[model samples]
Target: MGTEPDIILETRQLSKTFLGFTAVDSVDLKIQRGHIHALIGPNGAGKTTCFNLLTKFLEPSQGQIFFDGREITRDKPAEIARKGIIRSFQISAVFPQLTVLDNVRIALQRATGLSFHFWRSEASLRHLDGRAMELLAEVDLADFASQMTVNLPYGRKRALEIATTLAMEPSLMLLDEPTQGMGHEDVDRVTRLIKQVSAGRTILMVEHNMKVVSSIADRITVLARGAVLAEGDYAAVSNNPAVMEAYMGTTQGELEGIHA
Candidate 1:
């Protein structure tokens, strides 16, 4: 509910090393509360590594992460999610056999801390069902709520993933390639949905699609070889000589500006 100027996530001298190799090197990142910040780089640029460190999946070799002004460098992944940070994976992570409503209900139950109890009446879960349906509606998947998740098309599966993440009631969402393997239309659909979802929550994503990044990113951060290459609006980074050379394999004069 805060403006984009409010800092929602921060990393201080964050670093991750594997054996003798450094994946992320003393990276400092600041994400605003309600802006859609995009992280882009060539494959193996360590965008995913930075995400893992922020989400607490991987411990930093040195440095710390702060969320909502509280230090969370030592917290576990689930503990971080409990503190209102949720992430969506690149692959479709849904219960294939379960109905869409059931998938969302599971997330709702987790968010609300309601255990599955057969002996007790499910009256408490009725509230969770209402909330789950609300999230499905937000993602425009309410009509498919009773259908098996596997029956939906690939694009809708991604939508269901977003809905499941929304059921968690997160303030900041880290999405890893929301439109990773989609057709043109599907990509556009998910792109619009990402923009829609970013209104009330902070979104930090790693995207390979330059067009998509140029389209929806309010701010862009370019990383190459585990270090910050450029950080600015789309046009600034896209036009920067260093950024173009590092990722586009071109000189600054060869590439045109990325128009939003």
Candidate 2:
């Protein structure tokens, strides 16, 4: 007997529309537990729209969303987040004035949903310091805990964002373009960090960088014209003519680079 496929996230007929225009059609996607799933498409492929729908940043026009076998199509963003679905924001999310450790501490505070008005004291926040630093060290920011967030380099700043998100201790992480606008070294660094973090968590990401997706994705879903074009492993999707044709010419030579 074979073990069944463990799906952590499933969407049935999920869709979104803007007036007369359909941004995301009736699409179904499944992400297994402990897998790195990548959603890729051209600029107009509705990839980001699907992500917004999943994250509750934009509600779907019609569909059912199930996270860990629980229906969350009607749940609010905060409610869904509390259920262990957390999305990592872009690099600008960190507190510029606060130190790295302090930034993570605030995230942990927010995750706990503490009644800030009830108990207000630096002493109350003391116990969170060690846990915050542990999260920073998980992302390799242990040495820079005392540095102001704005003083960090662009890549480390992004790492701080990841650390802050980690403070939530999410079971499922949704990352949108985690390595966007990064140079070669930063991209490599963040890629490694992502792999490290995905050890026990399920990751669903909307990414344009084919190289990063190819390197880390356990399964790839290709979207085109607001719908899924292909779904499979990297080897399968990378070789699919439909997927290649979708990115041909419009993706600025990304397909050719993937071939190389």
Model 2 C-alpha lDDT per residue in residues 1-260, reported as the tens digit of each score? 22235998998888999997988998999999999999988888898899888879899999989987878999988788888888887212788988998888888887677723435587888799999989999999999999998899989998999898888888889998888889989998999999998999899988777888888999998888888899998888877888878876434345735521
Which stretches in model 1 have alpha-carbon errors above 4 Å?
1-5, 90-92, 115-124, 251-260
Which candidate achieves the best lDDT against the true structure? 2
**TM-score of every model?**
0.90, 0.92
Number of the top-ranking candidate, with TM-score as the measure:
2
Clash pairs (backbone) in predicted model 1:
none
Q: Rate the local accuracy (lDDT) of all candidates.
A: 0.83, 0.85
lDDT of 1 by residue, 1-260 (tens): 22234888988889999999999988988997789999988777899999999988899999988888888999998889888889875212688998999888877766656634424455756767778888888888999999999899999999999998887778888999888889989989999999988888899999887788888999988888898888999889877878877755665444432321
Q: lDDT score, residue 226, model 2?
A: 87
